[model samples]
Target: SAVISQKPSRDICQRGTSLTIQCQVDSQVTMMFWYRQQPGQSLTLIATANQGSEATYESGFVIDKFPISRPNLTFSTLTVSNMSPEDSSIYLCSVHGQDQETQYFGPGTRLLVL
Candidate 1:
Protein backbone atom coordinates (compact mmCIF):
# COMPACT_ATOMS: atom_id res chain seq x y z
CA SER A 1 0.00 0.00 0.00
CA ALA A 2 1.05 3.61 -0.59
CA VAL A 3 0.05 6.96 0.90
CA ILE A 4 0.54 10.47 -0.47
CA SER A 5 2.58 12.68 1.80
CA GLN A 6 1.76 16.03 0.18
CA LYS A 7 -1.39 18.07 0.37
CA PRO A 8 -3.09 21.17 -1.15
CA SER A 9 -4.76 18.44 -3.13
CA ARG A 10 -5.81 20.92 -5.82
CA ASP A 11 -5.22 24.41 -7.22
CA ILE A 12 -6.12 26.83 -10.01
CA CYS A 13 -3.50 28.47 -12.18
CA GLN A 14 -3.46 31.25 -14.73
CA ARG A 15 -2.62 30.83 -18.38
CA GLY A 16 1.03 30.88 -19.50
CA THR A 17 2.01 29.73 -16.02
CA SER A 18 3.07 26.35 -14.63
CA LEU A 19 2.35 24.12 -11.71
CA THR A 20 4.45 21.42 -10.15
CA ILE A 21 2.60 18.56 -8.52
CA GLN A 22 4.50 16.36 -6.14
CA CYS A 23 4.02 12.76 -5.11
CA GLN A 24 5.50 10.84 -2.22
CA VAL A 25 4.86 7.24 -1.44
CA ASP A 26 5.03 5.62 1.95
CA SER A 27 7.36 2.85 0.83
CA GLN A 28 10.09 2.60 -1.76
CA VAL A 29 8.57 1.78 -5.10
CA THR A 30 10.10 1.28 -8.52
CA MET A 31 7.50 2.87 -10.79
CA MET A 32 5.88 6.30 -10.62
CA PHE A 33 3.85 8.10 -13.25
CA TRP A 34 2.01 11.34 -13.94
CA TYR A 35 -1.44 11.51 -15.47
CA ARG A 36 -3.87 14.15 -16.66
CA GLN A 37 -7.65 14.08 -16.50
CA GLN A 38 -9.59 16.58 -18.49
CA PRO A 39 -13.01 17.71 -17.47
CA GLY A 40 -15.41 14.75 -17.56
CA GLN A 41 -12.76 12.66 -19.24
CA SER A 42 -10.59 9.62 -18.56
CA LEU A 43 -7.03 9.66 -17.36
CA THR A 44 -4.17 10.15 -19.79
CA LEU A 45 -0.67 8.94 -19.09
CA ILE A 46 1.75 11.84 -19.28
CA ALA A 47 5.04 10.12 -18.53
CA THR A 48 6.94 7.53 -16.58
CA ALA A 49 9.24 9.16 -14.05
CA ASN A 50 12.58 7.40 -14.04
CA GLN A 51 14.57 7.49 -10.86
CA GLY A 52 17.93 8.47 -12.31
CA SER A 53 17.22 9.26 -15.93
CA GLU A 54 14.91 11.42 -18.00
CA ALA A 55 11.22 10.65 -17.82
CA THR A 56 9.63 8.68 -20.64
CA TYR A 57 6.73 10.69 -21.98
CA GLU A 58 3.73 9.37 -23.82
CA SER A 59 3.14 9.86 -27.54
CA GLY A 60 1.25 13.17 -27.49
CA PHE A 61 3.17 14.45 -24.49
CA VAL A 62 6.63 15.98 -24.50
CA ILE A 63 9.36 16.59 -21.94
CA ASP A 64 9.57 20.30 -22.62
CA LYS A 65 5.87 20.72 -21.96
CA PHE A 66 5.64 18.39 -19.05
CA PRO A 67 8.94 17.93 -17.29
CA ILE A 68 9.11 15.18 -14.68
CA SER A 69 11.64 14.39 -12.01
CA ARG A 70 12.08 11.37 -9.82
CA PRO A 71 14.99 12.00 -7.54
CA ASN A 72 14.57 8.85 -5.49
CA LEU A 73 12.42 5.77 -5.09
CA THR A 74 9.51 7.38 -3.30
CA PHE A 75 9.42 10.96 -4.46
CA SER A 76 8.60 12.61 -7.79
CA THR A 77 7.17 15.76 -9.34
CA LEU A 78 5.57 16.80 -12.63
CA THR A 79 5.46 20.35 -13.91
CA VAL A 80 2.90 21.48 -16.44
CA SER A 81 4.48 24.41 -18.23
CA ASN A 82 3.14 27.32 -20.29
CA MET A 83 -0.40 26.71 -19.20
CA SER A 84 -3.35 27.57 -21.37
CA PRO A 85 -7.09 27.15 -21.18
CA GLU A 86 -6.73 23.81 -22.89
CA ASP A 87 -4.23 22.76 -20.28
CA SER A 88 -6.73 23.14 -17.49
CA SER A 89 -7.20 19.71 -16.00
CA ILE A 90 -6.66 17.48 -13.03
CA TYR A 91 -3.06 16.37 -12.78
CA LEU A 92 -2.35 13.22 -10.84
CA CYS A 93 0.71 11.52 -9.47
CA SER A 94 0.63 7.77 -9.17
CA VAL A 95 2.78 4.89 -8.10
CA HIS A 96 2.78 1.19 -8.78
CA GLY A 97 1.73 -0.53 -5.63
CA GLN A 98 3.99 -2.91 -3.76
CA ASP A 99 2.09 -5.81 -5.27
CA GLN A 100 2.91 -4.40 -8.74
CA GLU A 101 -0.41 -5.19 -10.34
CA THR A 102 -2.24 -2.39 -8.59
CA GLN A 103 -1.61 1.35 -8.67
CA TYR A 104 -2.31 4.15 -6.20
CA PHE A 105 -2.91 7.78 -7.09
CA GLY A 106 -2.64 10.96 -5.17
CA PRO A 107 -5.68 13.16 -4.64
CA GLY A 108 -4.62 15.17 -7.68
CA THR A 109 -4.03 18.84 -8.41
CA ARG A 110 -6.85 20.62 -10.15
CA LEU A 111 -5.62 23.47 -12.34
CA LEU A 112 -7.75 25.92 -14.25
CA VAL A 113 -6.05 28.14 -16.77
CA LEU A 114 -7.57 31.55 -17.09
Candidate 2:
Protein backbone atom coordinates (compact mmCIF):
# COMPACT_ATOMS: atom_id res chain seq x y z
CA SER A 1 0.00 0.00 0.00
CA ALA A 2 1.05 3.61 -0.63
CA VAL A 3 0.44 6.58 1.58
CA ILE A 4 0.99 10.18 0.54
CA SER A 5 0.87 13.31 2.63
CA GLN A 6 0.59 17.00 1.63
CA LYS A 7 1.34 20.19 3.50
CA PRO A 8 -0.67 23.36 4.04
CA SER A 9 -3.96 21.53 4.12
CA ARG A 10 -5.78 24.69 3.03
CA ASP A 11 -5.07 28.32 2.30
CA ILE A 12 -6.53 31.54 0.94
CA CYS A 13 -4.27 33.58 -1.26
CA GLN A 14 -4.49 36.93 -2.99
CA ARG A 15 -4.40 37.19 -6.72
CA GLY A 16 -0.94 37.18 -8.33
CA THR A 17 0.47 35.30 -5.36
CA SER A 18 1.94 31.85 -5.33
CA LEU A 19 1.77 28.79 -3.10
CA THR A 20 3.96 25.74 -2.94
CA ILE A 21 2.40 22.48 -1.92
CA GLN A 22 4.65 19.74 -0.68
CA CYS A 23 4.02 16.02 -0.90
CA GLN A 24 5.79 13.07 0.65
CA VAL A 25 5.23 9.43 -0.08
CA ASP A 26 5.80 6.67 2.40
CA SER A 27 7.26 4.54 -0.35
CA GLN A 28 9.20 5.24 -3.51
CA VAL A 29 7.27 5.50 -6.75
CA THR A 30 8.33 5.97 -10.33
CA MET A 31 5.60 8.51 -11.04
CA MET A 32 3.90 10.95 -8.76
CA PHE A 33 0.89 12.74 -10.22
CA TRP A 34 -0.34 16.24 -9.56
CA TYR A 35 -3.96 17.16 -10.08
CA ARG A 36 -6.42 20.00 -9.78
CA GLN A 37 -10.10 20.12 -8.90
CA GLN A 38 -11.80 23.40 -9.71
CA PRO A 39 -15.16 24.11 -8.16
CA GLY A 40 -17.46 21.28 -9.18
CA GLN A 41 -15.23 19.99 -11.95
CA SER A 42 -13.66 16.56 -11.98
CA LEU A 43 -10.01 16.18 -11.10
CA THR A 44 -7.64 17.06 -13.94
CA LEU A 45 -4.10 15.86 -14.23
CA ILE A 46 -1.70 18.78 -14.00
CA ALA A 47 1.51 16.85 -14.44
CA THR A 48 3.44 13.66 -13.83
CA ALA A 49 6.60 14.01 -11.74
CA ASN A 50 9.16 11.45 -12.65
CA GLN A 51 12.22 11.08 -10.48
CA GLY A 52 15.39 12.86 -11.64
CA SER A 53 13.68 14.59 -14.59
CA GLU A 54 11.52 17.57 -15.36
CA ALA A 55 7.84 16.95 -14.85
CA THR A 56 5.57 16.07 -17.77
CA TYR A 57 2.66 18.48 -17.70
CA GLU A 58 -0.75 17.90 -19.13
CA SER A 59 -1.86 19.76 -22.25
CA GLY A 60 -3.62 22.67 -20.57
CA PHE A 61 -0.85 23.49 -18.06
CA VAL A 62 2.45 25.17 -18.74
CA ILE A 63 5.66 25.09 -16.73
CA ASP A 64 5.36 28.76 -15.89
CA LYS A 65 1.92 28.23 -14.44
CA PHE A 66 2.60 25.04 -12.52
CA PRO A 67 6.14 24.04 -11.82
CA ILE A 68 6.73 20.61 -10.26
CA SER A 69 9.74 19.26 -8.48
CA ARG A 70 10.66 15.67 -7.90
CA PRO A 71 13.87 15.52 -5.93
CA ASN A 72 13.60 11.79 -5.44
CA LEU A 73 11.22 8.90 -5.87
CA THR A 74 9.36 9.66 -2.67
CA PHE A 75 9.09 13.42 -2.58
CA SER A 76 7.77 16.16 -4.84
CA THR A 77 6.51 19.70 -4.78
CA LEU A 78 4.08 21.71 -6.89
CA THR A 79 4.02 25.47 -7.08
CA VAL A 80 0.93 27.33 -8.12
CA SER A 81 2.54 30.36 -9.64
CA ASN A 82 1.15 33.83 -10.32
CA MET A 83 -2.18 32.90 -8.96
CA SER A 84 -5.57 34.22 -9.96
CA PRO A 85 -9.16 33.59 -8.99
CA GLU A 86 -9.30 30.96 -11.66
CA ASP A 87 -6.43 29.16 -10.00
CA SER A 88 -8.46 28.52 -6.88
CA SER A 89 -8.80 24.79 -6.69
CA ILE A 90 -7.97 21.72 -4.70
CA TYR A 91 -4.51 20.49 -5.59
CA LEU A 92 -3.77 16.82 -4.99
CA CYS A 93 -0.81 14.44 -4.91
CA SER A 94 -1.07 10.84 -6.06
CA VAL A 95 0.90 7.70 -6.71
CA HIS A 96 0.23 4.67 -8.83
CA GLY A 97 -0.63 1.52 -6.94
CA GLN A 98 2.27 -0.86 -6.67
CA ASP A 99 0.12 -3.92 -7.22
CA GLN A 100 -2.11 -2.31 -9.84
CA GLU A 101 -2.01 0.71 -12.14
CA THR A 102 -4.79 2.42 -10.22
CA GLN A 103 -3.91 5.81 -8.73
CA TYR A 104 -4.25 6.69 -5.06
CA PHE A 105 -4.74 10.30 -3.99
CA GLY A 106 -3.78 12.51 -1.11
CA PRO A 107 -6.33 14.49 0.87
CA GLY A 108 -5.38 17.55 -1.20
CA THR A 109 -4.52 21.14 -0.42
CA ARG A 110 -7.39 23.51 -0.84
CA LEU A 111 -6.50 26.95 -2.17
CA LEU A 112 -8.77 29.92 -2.51
CA VAL A 113 -7.44 32.63 -4.80
CA LEU A 114 -9.18 35.94 -4.35
Candidate 3:
Protein backbone atom coordinates (compact mmCIF):
# COMPACT_ATOMS: atom_id res chain seq x y z
CA SER A 1 0.00 0.00 0.00
CA ALA A 2 1.14 3.54 -0.66
CA VAL A 3 1.00 6.35 1.87
CA ILE A 4 -0.69 9.54 0.73
CA SER A 5 -0.60 13.04 2.19
CA GLN A 6 -2.29 16.30 1.25
CA LYS A 7 -1.24 19.85 2.03
CA PRO A 8 -3.36 22.55 3.62
CA SER A 9 -5.59 20.05 5.37
CA ARG A 10 -8.15 22.77 5.98
CA ASP A 11 -8.55 26.31 4.74
CA ILE A 12 -11.00 29.15 4.77
CA CYS A 13 -10.74 31.26 1.67
CA GLN A 14 -12.53 34.27 0.40
CA ARG A 15 -14.86 33.88 -2.53
CA GLY A 16 -13.38 34.29 -6.02
CA THR A 17 -9.99 33.18 -4.77
CA SER A 18 -8.00 30.15 -5.76
CA LEU A 19 -6.31 27.43 -3.77
CA THR A 20 -3.83 24.86 -4.85
CA ILE A 21 -3.89 21.53 -3.05
CA GLN A 22 -0.91 19.27 -3.23
CA CYS A 23 -0.94 15.50 -3.05
CA GLN A 24 2.07 13.36 -2.45
CA VAL A 25 2.50 9.63 -2.40
CA ASP A 26 5.35 7.67 -0.87
CA SER A 27 5.54 5.26 -3.76
CA GLN A 28 5.13 5.57 -7.49
CA VAL A 29 1.66 5.06 -8.89
CA THR A 30 0.30 4.88 -12.40
CA MET A 31 -3.25 5.91 -11.69
CA MET A 32 -4.02 8.98 -9.60
CA PHE A 33 -7.43 10.53 -9.24
CA TRP A 34 -8.87 13.69 -7.73
CA TYR A 35 -12.26 13.68 -6.07
CA ARG A 36 -14.55 16.11 -4.34
CA GLN A 37 -16.99 15.45 -1.53
CA GLN A 38 -19.58 18.09 -0.79
CA PRO A 39 -21.11 18.56 2.64
CA GLY A 40 -23.73 15.83 2.41
CA GLN A 41 -22.97 14.22 -0.89
CA SER A 42 -20.95 11.25 -1.89
CA LEU A 43 -17.53 11.55 -3.44
CA THR A 44 -17.50 12.80 -7.03
CA LEU A 45 -14.74 12.07 -9.45
CA ILE A 46 -13.00 15.27 -10.51
CA ALA A 47 -10.32 14.06 -12.80
CA THR A 48 -7.56 11.56 -13.48
CA ALA A 49 -3.97 12.78 -13.46
CA ASN A 50 -1.54 10.83 -15.51
CA GLN A 51 2.17 11.57 -15.30
CA GLY A 52 2.87 12.57 -18.85
CA SER A 53 -0.51 13.55 -20.16
CA GLU A 54 -3.16 16.15 -19.53
CA ALA A 55 -5.71 15.25 -16.90
CA THR A 56 -8.96 13.69 -18.05
CA TYR A 57 -11.75 15.41 -16.23
CA GLU A 58 -15.07 13.86 -15.34
CA SER A 59 -18.37 14.85 -16.93
CA GLY A 60 -19.30 18.00 -15.05
CA PHE A 61 -15.73 19.05 -14.27
CA VAL A 62 -13.89 21.33 -16.64
CA ILE A 63 -10.16 21.78 -16.89
CA ASP A 64 -10.46 25.54 -16.78
CA LYS A 65 -12.03 25.55 -13.36
CA PHE A 66 -10.03 22.73 -11.89
CA PRO A 67 -6.58 22.49 -13.32
CA ILE A 68 -4.53 19.41 -12.48
CA SER A 69 -0.86 18.76 -12.81
CA ARG A 70 0.73 15.37 -12.59
CA PRO A 71 4.43 15.99 -12.83
CA ASN A 72 5.44 12.50 -11.79
CA LEU A 73 4.13 9.22 -10.59
CA THR A 74 4.15 10.23 -6.95
CA PHE A 75 3.12 13.88 -7.00
CA SER A 76 0.14 15.81 -8.29
CA THR A 77 -1.55 19.12 -7.62
CA LEU A 78 -5.14 20.25 -8.08
CA THR A 79 -6.05 23.90 -8.15
CA VAL A 80 -9.52 25.20 -7.58
CA SER A 81 -9.70 28.38 -9.60
CA ASN A 82 -11.94 31.35 -8.97
CA MET A 83 -13.50 29.50 -6.13
CA SER A 84 -16.89 30.32 -4.73
CA PRO A 85 -19.10 29.09 -1.94
CA GLU A 86 -20.40 26.38 -4.18
CA ASP A 87 -16.88 25.10 -4.55
CA SER A 88 -16.40 24.61 -0.85
CA SER A 89 -15.85 20.93 -0.34
CA ILE A 90 -13.41 18.27 0.76
CA TYR A 91 -10.91 17.60 -1.99
CA LEU A 92 -9.18 14.25 -1.99
CA CYS A 93 -6.45 12.52 -3.91
CA SER A 94 -6.18 8.81 -4.40
CA VAL A 95 -3.77 6.38 -5.94
CA HIS A 96 -4.33 2.87 -7.18
CA GLY A 97 -2.82 0.20 -5.00
CA GLN A 98 -0.82 -2.86 -5.99
CA ASP A 99 -4.00 -4.71 -6.81
CA GLN A 100 -5.04 -1.84 -9.10
CA GLU A 101 -8.65 -2.22 -8.06
CA THR A 102 -7.89 -0.93 -4.59
CA GLN A 103 -7.20 2.71 -3.86
CA TYR A 104 -5.62 4.63 -0.99
CA PHE A 105 -6.71 8.18 -0.27
CA GLY A 106 -5.09 11.10 1.47
CA PRO A 107 -6.55 12.88 4.47
CA GLY A 108 -8.10 15.47 2.13
CA THR A 109 -8.07 19.25 1.93
CA ARG A 110 -11.18 20.86 3.29
CA LEU A 111 -11.97 24.26 1.81
CA LEU A 112 -14.56 26.70 3.00
CA VAL A 113 -15.22 29.57 0.67
CA LEU A 114 -16.94 32.52 2.25
Best-fitting candidate, scored by lDDT: 3
Clashes (N, CA, C under 3 Å) per candidate: 0, 0, 0
lDDT of 2 at 93: 94
Ranking by TM-score: 3, 2, 1
lDDT of 2 by residue, 1-114 (tens): 798899989999999989999999999899999999999999999999999889998899999999999999899999999999999899999999977589999999999999
State TM-scores per candidate.
Answer: 0.93, 0.97, 0.98
Clashes of 3: 0
Model 1 has how many clashing residue pairs?
0
**Local accuracy by lDDT, each model:** 0.85, 0.94, 0.96
- Measured with C-alpha atoms, the lDDT of residue 79 in candidate 2 is 99
lDDT per residue as tens, model 1, 65-88? 998889999899888899889998
Model 2 residue 56 CA deviation (Å) reads 0.6
Q: If ranked by lDDT, best first, what sequence of candidates would result?
A: 3, 2, 1
Per-residue error (Å), model 1, residue 103 = 1.0
Q: Model 3, range 29-77, lDDT digits (tens) per residue?
A: 9879999999999999999999999999999999999999999989999
Greater-lDDT candidate between 2 and 3: 3
Candidate 3 stretches greater than 4 Å from native: none
